[model samples]
Structure formats: C-alpha cells, structure tokens
Target: MVLEVVGVSPEEESVYRLLVTSGRATAEDLAQRAGLPAADAARILDSLALKGLASHTDGTPRLFRAAPPDVALLPRLKRSADTLELARLEATRLIQAYQDTMRRHDAGQLLEVITGAEALRQHLRQIQTCAQDEMLWFCKAQYVAMPSGSNAEEFEALARGVRYRVLYEKAFFDDEGAVDNVVAGVRAGEVARAVPHLPLRLAIADRSVAVFPLVAGGPHGSPEEPTTALVRDSNLLAALIALFERYWEDAVPLRVDGSDALSGTDGSGPAEALSPTDRKLLSLLVAGVADKAIASQMGLSRRTVQRRIQAMMERAGAETRMQLAWHAAGHAWL
Candidate 1:
C-alpha cells in the first residue's frame, strides 16, 4: 500500500531507513550503505529534514538521525486524514456534477450484468419495487425465478393492478403440482400462456427495465451459480418486448378448467381464447402445420407444442387425440 502521508520517493525512503538504522552517518557512508550516489544521499537527507523526519548536525561533515515516528510521521498522517475528509465532502458535488454533465449530453448507462443468484434475487425485488406499469416474463423449462422475499414481491406487484403476462414452455408444466401452481397465479390476476419452446428466461417490468438469464436453470439444466442482466429502456429491451408480444399473439390458452369465476382471468388464456393462429393450430392439427412452420409462427418449437398437447391428453385420461378433444369438449375446456 502507498503511504500517502509521507509520500516519499523510494530513494528517499532508502536513505531514511539507512539513517534510522545506522544512528548517525555521513552522506558518503550513507550513499555506500544505501546504494545511492553521494550527491543523491545528501539531497535525500536534506529532504527528509524538511519533512521533519530527520535532524542533522555539522561536525567534520553533516550527520543525520531519524526523528521518532510519533514526533514526525504522526503529524503528517493526521494532515493526510484531514485532507481525505475534505475530499470526501467535495466528492458528493463532483459525482452529481458528473451526472448532470452526462444528462446534458444525453448520454448515460443503460445496461448492467449482474452476477450471483442471491444478488440477482435482490435485484428482482428491486425491479418489482421500481415497476410502475406492467410486468412481462418468459419462464421456460424450469424454475428460473428464484422467489424473492418469500413470494411477497410478485403478490405486492399484482395487488397494485400492475399488468402481468407470463409465458411458459411446455417443460415448465411437467413439474409436479405445476398446474395447481399456475391456477393459483391465474387467480392472482396474472394472464398466463404456454408455447412449444422459449429461447431464454426473461423478466421485464414497466417496459422500462428487462432481465434475461446468463445461466440456464430448471429443465434446461441447473447451474450452481446463476447470472442475469438488467437492461434499461433501449432498442434491445424494445426488441425483447416485441418478441414477447409476438409469442403472446400466437400463444395457446394455458387452461385446465374453463370457468372464469374459478380463475378470475379475463378469458385471455390460450385455447378457447382464440386468435386466428389458435384456429389455424386447431385446423392444422387435423392435417399438420409442418412442426417447424408452426413453431416459427408461434415462437416455440414443434416438439414443445407436441409435448404440451400430449400432457393435456394424458391429463384428460385419454388414450388418443380424439379422445382428448372429446373429453375436453365435455368440460368446455376447448
């Protein structure tokens, strides 16, 4: 570490150390002992004397002795501490002045990479707190959202009438009790949907801030350490929002039961909540949409949609697709 208080050059320190150890010594002797030239040694001793770290007497030649550290270094250290305090006071203005300059230039920071799962969770809570309008998410294949503060954060946001649209991958529904959990969320005022595939896990709030994982988790694969990014309002964030809307437009109803009273969701869940795309999916299932084409249009994969359909078929306790449809129609779930 640098000793800013003394602030002496290496050569000066060498000269001082030599004198302090040697008691009293001539410049010529110190120069030899300290590996410095005679003139350099003399100059350093005089400099140390000026700092009050050393004292000198003239006899046959000048002899120098170090002052006790308490008498010398202590005062210099105190002055340094005082100077640092003054700098600390001025730092507030300096920082704000810089921020003002950046604002005037219309230049500022917008993106940040966040590391560590706990820290990311903290940021999630912060994001919820900061949100003012809507929240969007693309949670795929696994539990990407490590619940922050015991599920209180999302509930608080929902309680405030903030819009929530969450998309899930087919894999997200495979977990035990997943349907029950989703029904709970639907009851809590979140419009939810599922697609064949999701490219990444993401959370965007108020159209102002967005986060996407750098590490994969859930069905994708659990990482010991997870990381994500927080991108502020920018072209990248806009593109992400657009991507979600496209998927939302084609997404099928994530419904187990058709009763609006049971869930309180305004019939926006995929299935009977039909757009032209859902109708096409319904029609094409009879002929087939060439999995790739359907997946592309729906922002998921053919396999993902296939898996979801199969899961629904099994939930209906049916052995075939026709049976699944008949069973669903009986409950008006289609």
Candidate 2:
C-alpha cells in the first residue's frame, strides 16, 4: 500500500529497498547482490537518483548510495499530505459553490411546469395537503375534475380546519355525477359557489401558492395533453387571487334544502317561496349571469342548474329565460 501510494511498482520498491540497506556500492555489484541484471541495476539506480531516492559520487564508475531515509521519505510524505489538503479544500469549495448555484436557480424559478394527468393530481393533492389556513379554487374544465370521486383531499383539508372556497363553472355541472359530488362536499364543510363564466382552472392553497394548467389552445375544457404550473408568491399570483374574489362577489351558494319554492317561481310572485340560496341563484341570473356561472356558484352540475331554470320558466309560463326573469321580478319571486 505504501509503494502504491508513493507511485512505485514492486520491482522499483525492491531495488529501492536494496540500496537503502547497503548504504553505498557500484551499480554492477549492487545488482549482483540484489539479484538484478547489470543493465537493470544501472537503469534502476539512474531512475532512483532522478526520484531523489538515491545519489551517486562524481568518481569514474560512479558509486551510488541511498538517500537518508528520514530526509527522502519525509519530504515525499509531506508533499502527499499537502496535495491531499489542497484536494480537500477544493472539494469543500466545490460543494459550497454547487449549493449557491442551486439556491439561485430555485429562487428564480417561481413557476414550474407539470405534465400528464396523474402528475397533475399528485401536485394538487400535495398543495391542498400543505395548506394551513385556506384553499381557493376554480374548476371550469372537466379534465381537471374528472373521475370525480377522488375528492378526499378536500375533505382532509377541511378536517384540518382549513377553510375551502371552490368556484365551479356552469359547464362543470354537465358531468353525470358532479351535482352529487358537490353536495357531498357541501356536507363535508366546504363553502362552495357556482359561476357561469369562470376564467380558467386553478387551485390555490394557503394563499401562498397556486396550481394551474399551462394548457395550450384554450384555457377552459381542453382534453389535450395536460400541463400544469406551480406558482409561488408573486404579483401574478396576487392577480389570480384577486380574480377569484371578483367572481366570488357574484357567485351563488349551493343550497340543497329541497325547497319547493326554490324549484318553482310562484305565479303570484309571493315573497315567501325562495330560500336565501335560491334567491341568490335567481338574483345572479336576473343580473345576467349564465347558467354555467350559476352552477359554479352553487357547485351543482350545469345540467342540474339548467333543469332548475327550466322548471322556473315553466312555473312562470314563460317561453324563454329572459321572459322568465322579467316575470319573476314583476312578481317578486325572491
């Protein structure tokens, strides 16, 4: 191991050992005593002299001698130690430099792209799970909310005392089981609203971070290859939160009271028929919100909300949505 560390082969070490034991001798005699050929002895001694392991006299038929073991070996070992120290110091500097570069790269990367459907789900679940206070979300596309039964993440957040506010677009209710899923959510304690024309699909957890689709083509309901984004604190995130609030102000709450009055517009335009939830839905419609937007506010399926509107129109004996609204207002349906 010592020879290896010192970069000396076994044959070279043997020759070096022989010279060290014998103190001084001519090359040919040393080779004969050391079991080496004359030519081999000359070459080795010459090589050892160059390596500072041996020295020779200036006389003819030069007399070769081993260097003082203490002097020769100590300086070589010291050089090895110095080289090792320099390498260690260089490794430490490299590690520190790598850490700094990674920190800068991470700091500058506030937004990250996530591809594929299942990957998007994992990211959503992690974000929701980490939310400490609240989660704000908008679901305008089915591709984001499909296979609808995987809603345990939201309930888990609610269980953790995180307030959840979700906005579902009117079209979101068109899915077969969307109304039931939302009703289940309402029972689980999330405060949900429905709106007709939500801008895009998004989920923000703790107001510190957001996840959204970086979808190509259009922002709503495209079933193409899914690509999502993780957005950290930034002005862009602030605007996203602001956009939700703006729509929230006009959203309708989901009321599953099974009230007869809410389902029908009284011909007499009576004051007692509508529940607060019912009134909110109609009010948004009267204020020009589309069915999809109303569904978003209420978390009911778009189809469900449309059915309610159709029933209301039938009760008012109106042929169109606009007429039904005018009649309800004339009669004070709320």
Candidate 3:
C-alpha cells in the first residue's frame, strides 16, 4: 500500500515496517532488524522523512517513527509520486523513439566489400565486440597467424566466454603452434570443431552478421591480401549458417588421440579406410563442385576423377554422395 501510494521499493517498505512495528527505533536498531547496514538504514530513513512519510526526533542518538496514520501528507505524497512516474515514462518513450529512428537510418541490406588484411581485422573486431551468443567460423590456419605486437585477440574474446566454433582443414593438425592456440580456446569451453577439410574462410556472429572471402584463386591466398564480403542481412546469415551446418556435419571433430592433437581419437574409425586422395575426392563431391573442377584442382581428367569417386563410394558401401559424406564423416574417414 505504501509503494502504491508513494512509489517506495520493498527495501524502503521494510525499513518503514521496522519503524512502525518498533514504535520508535534508532537507525542501528532498524538496520539490524531489516538486515541492512546502519548507513543504508539511515539513508532510507532520510528519504522517508523527505517524503513526509516518516520522521526522526531531534533527541540523543536520534529515533525514527512513521508519520501518524491520519497525516494529511498521504494524498499529497501520492500525487507527487504519480507526477514523477509520468515524467519518467514520457522520457523513456522519447528515448525509444530516437533509437528506433536511428535503427531505421542505419539498417543495411546489400553485401559490403571488405578489402585488405587490416580491414578484415577491423571487421572481425566489430563482430567479436558485438557478439552476444555465438560465433561460428571456417578459416585456414594461416589466416589466424598473429603478427608482431598483435595479440591473439580472437582467443581473448573466447576466453571472455564467447561461444566459438571453428572448422578447418586437416593440415591445421600439423601446425602445432596454431593448433595449440586453438586448443587453448577449446579448453576454455569456448569452442567446438569440425575438421579434415574446410573450404573458404567464413565467419558469422550471433546469427546476425556474416563474413567470408570471395576466393578469386583458391584457399591458399595470402592472409594479408584476401578480399571479403561482409553481410548483415538476416536472410543472408541464415543461408550462411545452413551452409556451415552442412559442412560441419561432414567435418571431423578436432580432438584426436586422448590428447588434443588433430588426429586424436573421437571414437571408432571408419568401417573402411580410405587413401588421402579418396578423402579429398569425397570432400569435393559433397561440396557440390563439378567433376571438371575437381579434376582441374586434383590434376586429373574428368573420367579419372569420376572413376576414382565411384570406386571409393563402392568401397565405403555408400550409394549417394550425401550418404558417402555422412558415413565417412561419422567414421572419421574424410
């Protein structure tokens, strides 16, 4: 009833209740009963007195008491509270209106080009800072190599409790230093992984923003010179996430052996083993690349690539490329 009339909080109400129940009490006495410190109780009492709901007698050690039940200030205090609440709500609405207008003006749609390594770093920093839930990335190990005086900012972000997931090629296992850096993040419970072979670098933040390089040549491009597309549209982010899921499904968990090595034991190996070339071919097929492209990249003719893929699929006892990718990934074959 007091809060409805005078806009006091529960803590203040407790202090008032203590004074009323005690008839008259010192600040120290009220503090002990209300489970607050003497200083806090004194402040509450001062606020109540200023609102004319309570007062302290000017005697030795000072004693606080609630105002008389029939005090004429009750209605006046209610009126003052109502007026203050109205002003607060009006100011809140005005601030919200300004924020909505700014959002309308700044909302972006099309993909923006981000060129050069320094620019990429800045863009990544923005995503890291803005992330509230999760960050998913597919990157080459080389892209994350720290330069002189450059901190492992990405690792630091993960350490601060950002959920991170990364997909990278199997070659990352060979770079122990790079692998260790990523493993530190994993130990922090900030990361999950998919491995063996990831394509172009892709990053999505909080399911609201995405970044990926427009690989003109191939995956081995210079980190300091790659071109990127930075997208902020929800639809585009969804598409990118879907793509990541597909790749993640076909990638290996980074943990190998009992240790954190790339080739560590996740569980059982494939029912059937495959050569490195077979693994490579399977990855290419699952990615939806044409036979010609696979042939060109692998230095083989279309017919030879097709024959090899056919043999591997049959050996794995799989029918479709999708099934092949699924079983192979499950068994850690590719």
Give the range of the ten consecutive residues with the poorest summed lDDT in model 2.
Answer: 260-269
TM-score of every model versus the real structure: 0.48, 0.48, 0.50
Decide which is better by lDDT, 2 or 3.
2
Where does candidate 3 stray beyond 4 Å? 1-110, 144-151, 174-176, 215-224, 256-260, 264-334
lDDT per residue, candidate 3, 1-334, as tens digits?
4564556777877787777789998999998988898899999999888877788889878988888745735676768878989999999999977765664576544467877776877888788877877888876555432331243556667667777877766565455476666566666664445445666778898887898876542233453466788886546668899999766654445553357664322211353334466678778887889999999999978997888776656655779877777877777764
Give each prediction's root-mean-square deviation over alpha carbons: 18.1, 18.2, 12.4
List model 1 lDDT by residue over 37-132, tens digit each.
899888888999998889989676988899887887778788889988999889988997776566456534566778777777788788887788
C-alpha root-mean-square deviation, candidate 2: 18.2
Candidate 3 residue pairs in clash (backbone atoms < 3 Å): 256-263, 256-264, 256-265, 257-264, 257-265
Distance from true location, Cα of 293 in model 3, Å: 34
Query: Which structure among the candidates has the greatest lDDT?
Result: 2
- Model 1 TM-score (2 dp): 0.48
Q: Which residue pairs overlap in candidate 1's backbone? A: 142-218, 252-270, 253-269, 253-270, 253-271
Residue 120 miss distance in model 1 (angstroms): 1.2
Where model 2 places Cα greater than 4 Å from the true spot, the runs are: 1-108, 217-223, 258-334
